[model samples]
Target: MILIGRTPYATCQTAANVKALRTKLFTTDGYEPRVRPIDDQSLPIAITVDLYLLAINDLSEVSETLKTTAFLGLEWEDAFLRWTPASYNKTEYAFWPQVEMVGGSKGIIMDYYEANSGWDIIDSSWSVDTETGDSTINFSIRLRRKPLYFMLSVIFPIIALAILNLCAFLLPNECGERAGYAITVFLAFAVFLTIVSSSLPQNSESVSLVAIFLIIQTTCSTLITILVLALLRLGSFDEKDEKVAVPRVLTFLMRKLKWKSRSKCSKVETEKDGKMHDSQSSLPDASESKVSRIEMPTQLHENRLFKEASTVDEFSWKEVVVFLDVVLFVIFAIILTTSLLGCLVGAQRNAVN
Candidate 1:
C-alpha cells in the first residue's frame, strides 16, 4: 500500500523521539521558542513537522573561513554547519527552527522546492539512520552589522589618535612652539572624541573603547596643560634666580670665536697707529720716547679692558631669549614624555584585554 502524502511510516515515527533526544543533547532544558513552517510544493511528499526548536553552535572560529553555502558541503559532517545569507527580512529579530529527520535508510539528497504559500525551501539536505534513530538541525539569525560597527567606530580611531601623540617628541622647544602644538593636538583628539560619543549608544557599556580613549586623552591634555603652566612660571621668575643663559659649552665656544675676531681688529688698528707715530717721530725728538712709551701702554690697556667689558656684559635681550627658550624646551619635554607613556600604557592595556 503506497500512501501518497505524509504517510505514517513506522521508521519515521521516531522523528519526535529524535527531536527530543537531540534537543536535550544540545541545550539545557526549559527553553521556549517560536515555530515557523517551511514547506515545498514541488515535492510529491509532504513533511509534517512533529517537533521543532532552535539550535545554536559556537561558530566564531569557523565563521571567517566559511564564505558560502558551497563550503558547507565540504564540512557537512561536522557539528557546525555553514550558512550563506542571501537576504534577511525581519524587523524584529528571531531564531531559526531546528529540524529532525528519521526513517530513510538511504543517504538523504539536497532538495529545493516551492510551496503553495509562494515561499520556497531554497536548499536543504537530510539524513536518517536506524542506529542514530534521529538527528537535529539547529539555526539562528543575528544582527551582524552592529558588532562590526563597534569594532570600527570605537577601536580603530582611538588607536590612531594615540599614535598622533608620539609626534610631539620630534618638535624642538626654542621656537616658543610647545604651547600651540600641544593645544592643537589636544583639540584634534577632542574632536575625534566628540564624533565617537555621537556614534555610541546611550545604553552601551561604560567599558567601551571610546570611554577608555576619552579618559586617556583628557588626562593627557590636562597633564600637558600643567606642564605648560609650570614652564611659564619658571620663565617668569627673576633672571638672577633662573640661571638664564645658554649652556656653558656653547658660551665658551662663542666667546673664543669673538675673541679671535676682536684680537685681529685690535692688532690692525694698533699697527696703523704705531706706523703714524713712527713716521711723525722720524726727526728723533727728545720727548717722543717718553710720550710713546707711557701713552701707548696706557691706551692699549684701556682699549683691551673696554673690549673685555663689552664681551662680558649680559644684555637683557640675550637673557630674555635664553630664558624663554629654556622654558619652552622644558615644557615640550614634559608634555612629550607624559603623552608617550600614556599612549604606551593604553596600548598595552588594550592588548592584554
Candidate 2:
C-alpha cells in the first residue's frame, strides 16, 4: 500500500511506538518540559563539537575576511531523551528524535561564512551556565587565508618585476627601446606597490615587512630607470676621445681591472740591473763614475713611473658606465633576494604565532 503525505506515516504502529515513548518521556504525569531537562541539576551537560574543513570559498583582502565551508558534528548524552531498545521493540537500540537549535545559539562566532554553498556547514561550540542551570551549545569555526595565495600572487610577482627591472642592463645599447623598457618596468613596479600598500590598513601603528620589501624594490626600480637614462648618454661616449678624463671615483671603482704594480716593479728592477751592469762594464776603474751611474738610474726610474701612469690611467667614460651596470645589477639582485627572504620568514613566524 502507498502512504500519501504524512497522515498514515504518523499514525502507523511504528509511529505509535515513538508516540508512546514521547509520552513516557515528556508527558505531564512522567516529566515536565518546562523544568531543566536533566535529572542531576548540580552537574552541567557536557557537549563535544568537531569541525571538518571542506573548502575555502573566498578571501577578501580589502575587507580582511575569509569564507570557508566545513562539516560540524555535535554529540552529547541527554538523560531525558534516553530510551531502552527492549522496551520499545526487539532491536539494538531505540533512538530518540532529532534535536532542534534552541536559545538562538548565543555563543557562535562567524566572521566569514558560506550561506548557500551545498557543502557549507556551521561551526559548533557549547557553553553551560552552572549557576543558572542554563546551557547553550553554539557551533563556531574560524579560518584564515592560506599563505599560498599571497605568496604566489603578490610576493612572487613583485620579486619577478624587480628582477626584470635589473635586466635592462642586458638589453642592447643600440636598441632605442632600452630607455622605454626601463621606464615601463618602473611604472609597473609603482603600480604593484600601490596595490600592495593600499591593501594594507592605512594606519601608522603597524608596518608590514612585505610592504617594506616592495617599497625597496620600487626605489631600486626608480633608480634603475634614472640610471638607464643617464647611461644612454654616458655609455655612448666615444672611447677614443682623450679630452674627458674618467672620474677618479670611477678609476678607484675599477681597481680590480687595474694593472698590478708587482709586474711594473719587476720590470723597473730588470731595467735598473741592466743599466748598472752596462755602467760597470764601461767604466770599471772610476769610483766617481759609479756614483754618477747609480744617480742616473734614479732619474730613469722616475721617467719609467711616469710612463706606467700614462698607460695605466687610460680610462674612458664608456668603460666606467658599463662597469657600473654590472656591479649595480649584482648588488640589487642580492638585496632583492635577501630582503625578500627575511621579510617572508618573519611573516611566517608571525603567522605561526
lDDT of each: 0.47, 0.68
Model 1 off-target regions past 4 Å? 1-157, 204-206, 235-238, 241-353
What would the TM-scores of all predictions be?
A: 0.29, 0.47
Per-residue lDDT of candidate 2, residues 1-353 (tens digit)? 11111112222246667767768777834666566667798988788999967577777899999899765767777677666656766333344443323434455545675464223343455543323222223344533445667779897898789889889988766679989999999999888978888787655678888788888888888888898888878766654663466677777667766623343565667677767866665665575777776777776687678667654655556566667778778887888888888987988887666
| Poorly placed runs, candidate 2 (over 4 Å) | 1-143, 239-242, 257-313
- Clash pairs, model 2 backbone: 123-139, 123-140, 124-139, 124-140, 125-138, 125-139
Task: For residues 157-265, write the lDDT of model 1, one tens digit per residue.
Answer: 6556555554443344334776777677778778877787666554434455456657676666656655654554555443576654435554455455452344346
Query: Which pairs in model 1 have colliding backbones?
Result: 41-114
lDDT of 2: 0.68
User: What's model 1's lDDT at 134?
Assistant: 31
